[model samples]
Target: MGDLSLVRALGRGNIPVAVTTSERQSKVGFSRYCVAVVPTPSWVDDPEAALAAVIAWSEQQREPPVLFYQGDHDLLAASRGRERMAGHLRCVLPPAELVENLVDKQRFAAFAERRKLPVPLTRTLCRGK
Candidate 1:
């Protein structure tokens, strides 16, 4: 839903939008504003493969395109591969370590606690303990 909305917003702004998704049923590919739909490997399944696909797609573009990722897997893949992706694509992401910490619920809880971010109390449960 958010992806679709983003496509629409960017399209309305005259931005050339390209959507990268592994899901065949993803509606973003069908969006009228989408200039291209690049099929990528599922980042959760193969981060390296997905990042490679993204970089390969960027290589076809006249200029490095801004990359917008919607989920944690994509975010992590982009963050970890920031160096390799530097000349191929452009992304606005936090530091890789911060990206990793924010994606893990327990780690995010600890991070927030350490920073006194005013988040609600967070507790982790261990199984078979």
Candidate 2:
């Protein structure tokens, strides 16, 4: 999904892009939209490892590239490792407090409600002792 948009943007700027996928099947499809396709590990179960791998890949590039995150889990893992990875890559992310508030549905709704903003009706569900 991100590859297509990135390819289009890079093409507009005449920049070369490298797309990495974990699955062999994904490479064929992504290759058509990217300059190169590199196979990477699936970071589903181990996010730290995935973050490390991506950080390592970014460090190898001579010209720093913009990184875009498409998945919520991946975004969270990257946020947690921001201090360690700050120098190696650039992450376009919302403020930490904003991200935190948005991720928690209840907190987000309550905040919006407090401000008299338009938010859906929300209620907490609990198990009584």
For all predicted structures, in order, the TM-scores are 0.92, 0.74
**Candidate 1: C-alpha lDDT:** 0.87
How much lDDT does each candidate structure score? 0.87, 0.68
List where candidate 1 sits over 4 angstroms from the true fold.
Answer: none
Model 2 lDDT tens row, 94-114:
877777677678879978887
Best by lDDT: 1
**Looking at model 1, how many pairs of residues clash?**
0
lDDT (10s digit) by residue, model 1, range 1-129: 128989999999999898888898789889999989888888799988988998998998899999888888888888999999998998898988899889999999999989999998987788997
As a whole number from 0 to 100, the lDDT of residue 112 in candidate 1 is 95
Q: Give the clashing residue pairs of candidate 1, or none.
A: none
RMSD of each: 1.7, 2.9
